[model samples]
Target: MQAIIFANRTGNELAPLEQYYCSALLPVGNKAVIEYTLEDIVTSGITKVKIIISSQAQEIEQLLGDGERWGLDIDYFLSKPEEKTAAVLDRLSLSMTDSIIIVRGDIFRSPCIANFIDFSKQFSNEFVQAKMANQNACMLLLPAALSYLDGIDWPLTHDYDSNSVVTLILHGRCHMIDSFQSYMNANLNLARNDIPSLTPMERSFTSANPEQDFYVGAKTHTGDLSLQNAWGIIGENCRIDPNVVMKNAIIIGNDTLIDKGSTLENCLILPHTYVGEGLEVNNSILCKKLLISLNTEGHIEIDDQALIGPSEHQASTSSTDRNLSTRFFILMLLIASLPFCPLLAFYALIRVMFFKLETKPLIQEMINDNLGRSLVTYSFNVPTRLLSLLPQLFLVVTGQLALFGAPAQIRYATGRNKQRLGVFGPVQLLLDEDAPEEERMLLMLEFDNTHTSTKYLSLLWRSLRIPRLLGAERKKQNMTH
Candidate 1:
C-alpha cells in the first residue's frame, strides 16, 4: 500500500531553528528528521509516497529528490499550513478500497514502522491507531475507518465501532516536538538510545575512562576528554580540547569545538558552534554564541568571543571583533550624527505636543551586539524612517549594528518587523531600493559573508548618498500621490 507523509508543517514551534530550515530538514542526532521518516517508510516496504510541503519547499525538494535511492517514486504536493488535513487527503483521491499509512514527517517516533505494522496486522477491516502514553505517533487508515478522518482524536474513545476498533501500544517513544522543550527532550531520548528506530551514526571513538562512553565520528580530537559517568554522540571534524570535563548525556554536532578548561554536561551542541574556554555549559542547546536552556526554555547569547562564538569565527576573521578601521568608520559616523540628535528629539517633542502622537521619541529594541554573539538593547525605534534614524548611528558606533552589512536596518526597512530592531543597515546602499526581497537578501548575505576593508569603504561612500536618495524618492512618491 502507498503511504502519504505530511512534511508540510509550518513548525512555528521549533523557532530560531525553524529560521534556518523547515522542521523536516532539522538535524537531530546528526540526521535530518525526515531521513528517519524515510527509513521507516522504506523499511515498512512502502514504495509510492507523497510529501506535502509549503515554505522552504525548494530545500526539502533538493534533499529528497524523487526518492530514487530508496527504490521508490516520490511526489510532492503544496499545501497551506492552515488547510485541513482531510481536504488534502481527499484531494489526493487515495483509494476507497485499500488501506494506507499516514505519518507526520516532521516529528520523530520510535518502534520502527515495520514493528508497528507487524503488530497491527491482527485487525483487517478497522481503524488502527498507534500511540505511546500521551501522544499519537501514526495511524493505519482502513477503508471502513477513512470516513472518520476529520473528527478523530487520540483515545479512540468515542464515535467508532467499539468492537471493530483496535489500539496497539508499542510501548515506544514519540516526540511530537510541538515545543522547543520537547525538541530538546527528543535529543535526550536519542542520547539515551530510548528510540530504538534511530541508530545515531556508528559509535567510533572510545573514551579514556572505562566509565565514559562516546559515539564519535571521523577526524574528531577526543584526546582530552575527561568524563565521569558520561555518554554521548559527537559528530565529524570536531575538536574536544585538553582539560575539558564532560558528564551525563551530551550530543555535539559536526564541526564543533569544545575548548579547554570547559565543563559540558547534559547539553546538545549544534554544528559549527564553539563553546568558550573555561565555561560551564549544561542542559541546553548551544549554537554559535546562542545558549538555549532546556530546563527554563530561556535563551541567551554570549558576545565575548573568548567565551562563546561560531567555530569558524574562532579560527578565522571574526565578525564579532571589529577591526580598527571599521571602528574608526563607525566613530566618524557617530561624530557626524551626534549633533543631529537634539534636533530630532525637538521634532519628536513637537510632534508629540501638537499631533497627538503617542509614540515615544525613541523606543528600546534588542539586537546582537557583535553580529549574533551578544544581545544588547538600545533606543533606536523612531516613527520617522530616514532622517529620524540619525540618532541610531550610535548603534553602529557601538558595534550593535553594521554600516555595510545586512539590510536589517531599522534604518532601511521596507517591511514591518519591529522585533529586535537595529539601525544603519547598508542594504539600500548596495542594491536598488526597488529590488526584490530575494535580491536584497542575497546582497545582504554577500555583505555579511565577505566584509573586506575595500568593500566596506565602498559601501560607506555609497551610504553618504542616502539623504539625496531619500529626498528624491520622497518627491517621486509625492508626485505619484
Candidate 2:
C-alpha cells in the first residue's frame, strides 16, 4: 500500500505562529509537527508517497527533500490553497489507485500506522477509521471503500461514516492546533512526555541534583535549576543562563537563549529567540518580538530587543528593522561624522600625549568580522572609551562598521562573534568591562538583533550620557565587589 499526506493547510488560526512558520512546520519538542507523520509512514513501511503542499510550500519541500533521508520515495504536489482532499486526489490521478493510507501532515499525529493497517486490512469493502482515546483524527480506506471519498473532509472529520464504517479508538494521540491555546497545551504536554512514544527526538535526561527531569539536547549550555513536578526540554546549541528558573513543562527551541535571572514556566520559546534577564514568563508563546500570552489572548510586540528579541541570524530577518531609509540615514550620519574626524583625531592625540592615555589598545583582535575589515586595534593605557572610538571613525568612513552598528568590545567581552561590530551599541554603553559574560552577551544580542536607524541615532545622541550609564555600571560593579 502507498501513503498520501495532505500538507497544504495554511493554519490561519495559528496566527502569530504563521508569522514565522506554517503550523505543519512548527517545532514540537525538537522536530516539526509533520515529521511525526512522515516517521509514522516510514514505520508502516510505506515506500512511495505523495505530499501535497501550499503556502510556504518551498519550505516544506526543502524540509522533506525527496524523503531520501527517511528511505522513502516521495513526490511533491503544490496544491491550491484550501483544496479538498478528494479534489487533490483527482488532480493527481490517484483516486483509482489501490488502498491508500491518507495522512494529514498539517497537524500533530502519532498513531501506530502499522498496527492500524494490520487491524483494518481485513476489510476490503468498508471504510476504516482509527481514533485516539478522545478523537478520530486518522483513518484508512479499502479499495472498495474508495466510493466514500465525497463525504469525508480534509481533516479526519468522520461525519460521513455510516453503520458500515469501523471506528477503532486506539492508544494513538492527536493534538490539534486549532487555536493558540491548544497549540501551547500540545507543546507543553509533549515536553513532559505526556504522549507515549510520540516524542520524535531523544534528549539526555539528567538527574543532577534538583534538576530531576531535565531533558537537554546536545551542545546546549545550561545549569541546574530546581523543579517541582516540572520538566524542561532544551533543543540543540541553546545558551540558557545558569541562574534561570524553569518550572512546569517547558520547551525551549533550537539555538535559543534564556538569559540570567529569568523564570520560565509552562511556556514554549520558539527557535532563535533571545529571552532577556529577569523576565518572568509563564504560560506564553514567544516568537521573536511577538509575545503571545495565554491569559491576554493577544500579542505584544516589543520594540526594545534589549528586553527580549531574536538571535543574530533571526535578527537579520524581519526583526532586524533595517531598511533603505534607515540605511540611508546611517549613511548620512556617517557623512556627518566624517567632518569631526579631524577634531576627534586631534583630541585623541592630545589625550595620548598628555592626559596619561596610551593608544596601544588592541588593533589585531578578531571577533567574527563578516565585513572583512583591516586589522586595527585601539587599546589605551587608561579606559578612555571616548578616545578609543576616535580611530574607528575611519572604519565607519570605509563602511567597516555602521555609524551605530553592533560592535564587540576589543578587550574583555566574549559576546557572540556573529553580531556585527558597531561604533556604538547598547552592549558598549550599558555594560562595564567587569560585567558578567552573560550580561554582555545578552545586551549585544539584543542590539545586534533589533538595531534600527532610529536606535542608531538615539545611541549617537546618547553618547553624551555615556558618563552616566558607565558611571552607573561602575557603581554597580563597586557595590558587587
Candidate maximizing lDDT:
2
> How much lDDT does each candidate structure score?
0.67, 0.69
* lDDT tens digits by residue: candidate 2, 227-303: 33457677898998888887776788888988889998788898889988899898899987788988876888887
TM-score of each: 0.61, 0.63
Error of 1 at 277 (Å): 2.3
Best by TM-score: 2
Instruction: Go through the candidates in order and give the C-alpha RMSD of each one to the true structure.
Output: 10.1, 17.6
lDDT (Cα) of model 2: 0.69
Model 1 regions lying over 4 Å from their true place: 118-122, 150-164, 208-212, 226-229, 303-306, 315-481
In model 1, the Cα lDDT at residue 160 comes to: 40
Candidate 1 residues 303-332, lDDT tens each? 888887778766535654455567688688
